[model samples]
Target: MQENQIDHLFQQGFSLHQQGRLEEAQVIYESILKLQASHFNALQLLGVIFLEKKQFIHSINLITKALQIQDNQAPCYYNLGSAQQGLQQYEEAIARYDKAVAINQEFAKAHHDRGVALQELQRLEEAITSYENAIAIQGSYPEASWNLSLCQLQVGNFHAGWRGYEWRWKNSEISKTAGLRNLKQKLWLGAESLQGKTILLHAEQGFGDTIQFCRFTRLVSQLGAKVILEVQPSLVSLLQNLEGVSKVIARGDPIPECDYQCPLMSLPLALNTDLNNIPGVPKKFITCC
Candidate 1:
């Protein structure tokens, strides 16, 4: 096919790619590659489609070939890094991200994903730095900020971590999975006095998180509030008699009337908890379940 014809086909494929019609885009990109095997754009884009499709090896192969055709493309390097990351090749992904940032120092996404790759390998400090770099470039980058908070918490920087944990609400995926409550009551993040108030402490994550953080209900009761604990259906019976809990109910049960509410996970931040002052059931309060 003529160069102009190939260019037209590439434009169509790229348009489809931008529209998220991956299968159609892949077909056009493949057709372009068949006509002109050395087509850099086609190779790179098809690789990206493969990456999106979760065909990591095929993505790696095609993107590698595109890099061979033109090694200086920053986006290609970033996409290659993404493919590597998807395959759990953390070290390789980091290397690719490094190359991308070397080509474009202001590549906030590259820096953020490099942090993710490092974090996957349990390199917390390095991941923190990379996430910070991403935030520095793109001040409004929520994912990087959120991940940085998690790393900080893992490293015992509870205050900073919990402060950043508030960013989780800004993430759509987390908000959906956590089942954000649409209550009329105010969200109590320990900023307001809970004195004489009725508060609902609801589970936001998994059963494990619910169990671990439910201890905060005692602290809430200590604040002169009536604590109503909401947990998974299975744990409702187990935690019904927990100290400081005036009521325990399954998640799907009707929410009782309350003046304020908080997620169990956010209780630490709400109560100013730290490593030195983490709240838990006292030995005297422990009972045989």
Candidate 2:
């Protein structure tokens, strides 16, 4: 095919990709490679499409081909890192992310993703640094801030962690998953006095988190507030035994009238929790029958 014809096809494919038509874009990219085997853009973009499709091996191969044609591009390394991450090759992913950052020091996403891989490897301190670098580069990066908070929390740095944890509400994925986006009620972020107020404390993440943080219910009550604990149906019976909860309601049930609301995970921040004074039950909260 003529060079102009190849360029036209590439443009068409890129347009399709921008419109979220991955399959069509892949077909066009494949067609471009058939006409010009070393087409760098086609190889790189097809690799990205494969990555999105979760075909990690195919993504690696195509992206490697693109690198052979043009090895200096930061995006190629980033895509390679993503493919490696998909295959659970976290070490390899971190190396690739490192290369991407080395090539382009302004690659904030590369730093953030490297932090994720490090966290997966249980290198919490290194992961925190990586996340902090990303945040320093892009102050408004919610994902990086959230991950940084998680690493800090894992390392028992509750003070900095809970402050960073506030970014979770700004992340679209977390907000959507927690179903907090549509709620019009104000989030009680420990700034308000709970005295004489009916506070709705809702479950946010998983059963483990709910179980771990439910100890805060008694603290809220001690502050002279009525607590309505909304939790997963599976935990409703168990949580009923928890003290200071005025009522235990299952998730998806209609919430009663309340003066304020907070997510379970946010309880640590609300109560000014620290590692030395972390909340705990006197005994096991649950006893298996």
Candidate 3:
């Protein structure tokens, strides 16, 4: 109940928070709030813990209370923005991120997250600007670069988009889900000729993505390369008769020996595909469901 006692509890909570002990920190922070209802630091940090725990509504309420007690705190605004983002409230999140950056121009994560919110709203240009701002503030921000690439691709800026798309290897979610393949063969990314060589084109994402990009196998074949396509098991039978593919095998099956390899999604970049020149869906592959 004493001021020093509250401070000691806060310090303990903050230490636990920094160590990623969310439940323990939450208990300490809750105790601090009970003694001093308007305890700004306790409210703000607890709000962050709730955000990390995916308790978005609770995070929003606590962060809002913290901001009322101390309106000038930039981190509180940023946390509020993240909580809003977790709730898919893009407009509100953008407002909070705007406030955070207005208070501290060097807030790179705020700028990047603001870009994400804007991108969700389909505001591609604004999202690109926000991502660029984040990158300017922190030159090594790969997440921003990767999101910027998606925006660029959406707007048909293929030259810049494909170049920026390489940053996906550094984006955490994409890396975790569809990681870079450790291959003995060289990665073909539009630089080398596939002529007189066999190239393994494997699916890296969803079945839909594999189906959509499989059209590029014909283009690869046109370059005089033998194309061996590896796709999801469900699509192996469906895609077996696809044009220009020498072999179509299910993923997890033994892939044939090839001199070059590329993920299906990366084929657009590897083949220098553009908006006007995108290969059409071949008639043979289309059957009405």
Candidate 4:
């Protein structure tokens, strides 16, 4: 194909990609490669489409080919990092993200993703620094802030972690997946007086988070609040017997009217939990069936 024809096909493929028609875009990119084996855009974007499709190895191969054709493209390294991350090759992903950042100092997303890779590798301090760098580059980056919170929590920096944890609400993906309650009631974040009032403690994360934090329900009740706990359906039977909980409602059930609300994960922060004084697991909370 002539140069103009290749550019036209590339534009068409990119347009399809922007429309999220990955399969069609992949075909067009592949056609471009058939005419020009070393076509940089075709290889790079096809690799990205494969990465989106979860074809990690193919994604890596194509992206590597793109890098060979043009080593200076920062996005190529970033996409290569993503493919490595998909395969759980954290160290490789970090190296690729590092290269991306080295190529473009303003690459905030590369720094953010490098932090994710570092966190996966259990390098919490380094991950925190990486997240901070990303935040410094892009102050309004919700994902980096949210991840920095996790790294802080992992290292037992409760004050900063929980404070930053609130950024999860700013992340559209997390907010969508975790399904934040849209109640107009105020969120009780420890300082609120629960005296003579009903408090709704809803589970906003996975089962493990609910199990771990349900211990706070008793503490809430101890403060003279009517504690209504909402948990996943699978845990309703187990938690129904929990002491101090006035009512245990399964998720999806209509939540009773409450004066305040809080996500279960935030209970620790609300209760002023720390590494040394973290609440012990309730003896009967976990038992074999």
Structure candidate 1, residue pairs in collision: none
Q: How well is each residue in 1-289 modelled by candidate 2, as lDDT tens digits?
A: 7899999999999999999999999999999998999999999999999999999999999999999999999999999999999999999999999999999999999999999999999999999999999989988999999999988888878889898898888898987775563455678878988888999888987788888889888888998999999999999999997899999999888889998888888888988987545666333452211
In model 2, the number of clashes is 0
Q: 227-287, model 3: which lDDT tens digit per residue?
A: 9998889999999999999999987898788999998888899888776567895556544
Which residue runs of candidate 4 sit more than 4 Å off their true CA positions?
A: 281-289
**Collision count for each candidate, in order:** 0, 0, 0, 0
Cα lDDT of model 4 by residue, 188-280, tens digit? 898978889999999987888888889878888989999899999999999998988999999899889999999988888788876655667
What are the runs in model 2 whose C-alpha is more than 4 Å off?
A: 181-185, 252-254, 281-289
RMSD to true structure for each model, in Å: 3.7, 3.8, 3.6, 4.0
Per-prediction TM-score to the true structure, in the order listed? 0.94, 0.90, 0.93, 0.89
Query: Which parts of model 1 are misplaced by more than 4 Å?
Result: 281-289
Error of 2 at 237 (Å): 3.4
Q: What's the ranking of the predictions by TM-score, best on top? A: 1, 3, 2, 4
Top TM-score hit: 1
The best candidate by lDDT is 1
lDDT score, residue 246, model 1? 94
| lDDT (tens digit, per residue) of candidate 1 on 1-289 | 7899999989999999999999999999999988999999999989989999999999999999999999999999999999989989999999999999999999999999999999999999999999999999999887998999999998888889999998888878877877788888799998888899999999987888888888888989999999999898999889999999999989889889999999898989988877666776465653321
lDDT of each: 0.91, 0.90, 0.90, 0.90
